[model samples]
Target chain A: MLILQKISQNKTLAATINQIHYVVIIGEGLVGGALRDYLINTFNYKFFYNVKTPWTDKTLIEAHFNELKTFIFEKIFNSQKTELAAPSFLQLSFVWSAGKAGFAASFTDIDEEEKDFHSFLNLLTQIDQERPAFVKMDLHFTSSAGGLFEGQSSVQEDSQPHPLRPYGILKLRQEQKITEWSQNKSYFHGVIYRLSTVYGRIRRGQRMGLISIMLQNGLHKKITPITGDLYTLRDYVHSMDIARMITSGMISSHKPHKSPSNNLQVLFGLSQKPTSIFEIKAIIEFHLKHKIYIQFNHTPGNARDITFGKIQPPFEVQARDIRSGIKDVLTDWYGAHT
Target chain B: MEGTLSVSTITPVYCGAQYLEELIKQLERVRQEWQSKNYPIQIVESIFVVDAAKDDSLAILKTISNNKAYPWIKVIELSKNFGQHPATMCGVLYSTGDWLITLDEDLQHHPREFIELFKAFAASSYDVVYAKPKDSVHQSLFRDWGSRGYKKLIAKITKNPFVIDFNSFRLIRGSIARAAASVCGHETYFDVAICWFTNKITTQKLSLEDQRYINTGTSSYNLFSLLSHARRLIVSSQTKILRLGAWIGIASILLSVALGLHFLYLKIYDPEAIPVRGWTSLYLTLLFMGGLTSTLLSIIIEYLSSISLQNQGKPLFFMVDRSSDALIQKFLNHEPIDH
Candidate 1:
């Protein structure tokens, strides 16, 4: 068991009295990986159990979830005994940032994704049923802003979910499941983060973002075919910013007066600025210091301009500027390739 | 159906809850129509700026926008009722398209007419295209006559030839539209500001009927609003009407001088023709004083008009790129646009 204490040099982390006993991350994809990194480095949490299962295989996935439930039960039981020996506050967080489908996913793919999501929800029910009385549970579910509000522009905070594809429908369904789960538990604090188009460093075997793909194609001197036209707009937020927001949200929720509640708080994770594909291409080209060829395929149904209105959420962090972020990603890519 | 040209349609909603759904449905049809015909143009987004309606228009707009089918519907809510021009300006600034078409929320301007507007725009080197009503819009003869007569009279008075063509149903180049919107102050009339940017404006004849007025026998613009609009338009424009005052004053001074000369001739050459002892002198003095006052008032108005123009943030010059006109031309010519 790794007992991690706050470093004295890091004043911000040291100042907070948050004692998160356990954090179970359900996914290890781009967003989940970034979040885990933040928790270990910036957030300074050592106890973590990463839940990974083949989302497509129902039997194996269910068995894996059962094991996860047993793991959590034993850990909490031990932590409770330790709390009696030394009086302290304990917090348990379940971060669900997993998805196996893209916006252009087929119906079959979405169905499998939906099944995996249901299994995860079942596990949550099991944990909620047997959880200790004193342990506060904070559930953070990652929802897609692009999927929920596809082809929409100037999406307000109160705007309804208008999912275009099956992938979007699945995301909405997952959010509904989490909302339903949190309804009965008074100790359950739920946060649904509707993330806009997320761009970041691409990990191997994971889905690549437009910016990352553009840089990759540019490096290989290959022409990238865009399914959307130059004028298509989207709100892109970096994944690290999403991590910061989620951590901040958890910290804010644990304050004395701001205790756990059954009612789920919805927050839009967005940059609040709509960037056009043309502008993005220019930015990439400027950073790459070369003109990259892009052919606009613009598949008729795939081209939808999704933009978000200005929303200042309570847990928002100062978002990294798109230009500098792109530059950093490019530099990282260049370093790795070289 | 994808094309190089993109268009954004802006509608300012105020007490237009009844017609909004039908308006959106009609726009959808036009969107589908364009896509089916491969019209080399796409309706990128439809922006509805709700200017704080007294009714449940905003709620209905939200409901309509959230339907998943109309994902391109963007709603902008003002803090309070900022009137139509400001709301329209807000929509224009939010728009991200190659061209912008502004229409009423009352379903008066049918979305199908956009084809005609687009055709006219593509055929000419115009920056703005206004849909000219083929017949009566209000159905009431008096109202129609009044609307036309007011526009013509304003056009003559202000010497703004485009005033007669200033219909709410208009297609403006996106760059020009946004640029015009950016410089607009609180009281700046939107159409007047547009005129200051580019004079390449044309009109397309279309059959338009104000369905709301026809059904309800009332218009969004009552007599008070129209008058207010006229006053704003006059104020926003560099009106030649002010110069008319100076011209009239000069004519008066000249007339008074000629009359004074005539009176002097009568006094000197023909003494018997004089009706009274000092009548000629008194009349000449009054005429001269009246002319001087008129001239002084005109000069004062001239100074005020200059100040008003400056206050309105009238740009010294505006730069626009008409390079996309070639694409529209190709589209109009039925040539393949992708190449």
Candidate 2:
């Protein structure tokens, strides 16, 4: 009964934002880490991401969100420091980049990620319920283009998502759940970003995309397994470019033209260049000055081509080309390792 | 090919350093011509696949591609030479357009003729339109005759009537081109693999000249490479000749059986009707053994062909969207196209 009342109260809050005080990141993986780095170092924004907390654990996740709430409240309400110009309405921006499932993930793994996502959402709901009536909350969920649009060619903004695997289904469900969770809560603004094949940055213990894996393996002269055909096309976008776009979107006060009834903006993040594995291999080999050993073992998940068209305006950001991006990534890896 | 429809031009480069500059110049003129005319068509990208040519082709291509005058030119340099067909396939796989046009690097196929190819493709419901040379491509009787004879003989052998019409200068529907290129294996002939998807192929006659061949009496194809091309084409095709062999084998077996029965009847009824002493037994034995060998060989060949096709990644059904082609047809017919 208490939970029901809290949910009902949270659903009715009006969304009016004048300023943002606290920026929080839920996941610190590839995209999350890049976003966090950009916000803290580049933009000098007040971004909070707790690495020690296990977000997937149901019991600990609630406590983690509570701690985050306390941290934000202390920084915004208790402190004299002004994160932003003093305004009547203060808002909180949450960038949810927390997903453990990938294109090749099993059903069990995807199910676990879904549960983690729900727990995270429940915590957000709790925050909304307990927050002062003046504060607004915005969420930016990083969805997967490779998953949601797998087996699709020339994917446009209006293309209907037909998820072929559990990973894609989970992504689609997350998008729907976010929409539902923020429904009628004008105080909640949601932006769902469907990102294409992201590659760059070699972080420890975090999974990397094909480009990174090929570069890392190339340095060691290790044989890389090719799971897709040589001609399978994909749109590759850099992680930093994603970080830049998300950061700009979060900071910009410009809202979409859509009605505030839903208060949700769905955008596709892509480079709009459909490149093939054969081309990618050639580029990498050219940059590395040595042939990267590859063994072809086509997988069901990557058997089809997933190419994205030009992203719509107002949400589009210039993405780095694959050739120069690969060069930069390889050079960075080489500098760090050798 | 339609309102805001994009096209990509691909050239497989191998020892054409001298012609790269002129080729780019011509392509640029075409690109400008299309833009100024506003024919609802755009040359979105021009891809050059450098097949690790033995000359200065790669260097020249890189320099020209990096020039600000031709920003749409994309140069893909392979680590090693993968031959012309593979290089072209590599470029096709990288292309993102509604239509794809492939030509040679030596400027044998003029960029001006691109409009002719487009008119041909748009005028019909064909997925592939080849720019057939109305005159001799090399203007050398021996060379032209050899090329024609080669295609004719291969077409007769493989029983694919479209073989004689295949040319390097072609305009292929982008989807079919990419699909075919995607399925091409190391041994799969790119043109033959493309035919597996759609049979809506046509040809447009165009006056073309091999300037390099005429200037230097040398061409990209030599005796060895021509043989290799023939082998690859035949291997990639499901030759009807093999089926004919099987039928012939069965007919021979039936005829041998009839003759054996007749010989037995003659011996039983009238021994004097037999002209030779052991001719019947010898003749039947040879005929039966020959038939059995031919039948076994044909079955083996058929099984091998099926396995080869499967390994080549032949798609069961490829979906194509011709809605854009309608707009292209309207534009060609001087009808107003909706933006």
Best by DockQ: 2
**Cα interface RMSD of each candidate:** 7.8, 6.9
lDDT for each residue of candidate 1 in B205-315, tens digit (9 for 90 to 100)? 999998878988988899999999999988898777777777777787788899989878888999899867987777777877777888898889888888787666565
**Model 1 C-alpha lDDT versus the unseen true structure:** 0.78
Docking class of 2: incorrect
Model 2, stretches more than 4 Å misplaced?
A1-25, A28-195, A198-338
lDDT of 2 by residue, B194-269 (tens): 8998999999999999998899999988999999999999988988788888888888899899999999999999
lDDT of model 2, residue A234: 85
Cα lDDT of model 1 by residue, A167-231, tens digit = 88989988888877777776767789999888888565678678778878887789988888665
DockQ, candidate 1, comes to: 0.04
Task: List TM-scores of chain B, every candidate.
Answer: 0.93, 0.97
Clashes of each: 0, 3
**Candidate lDDT values, in order:** 0.78, 0.78
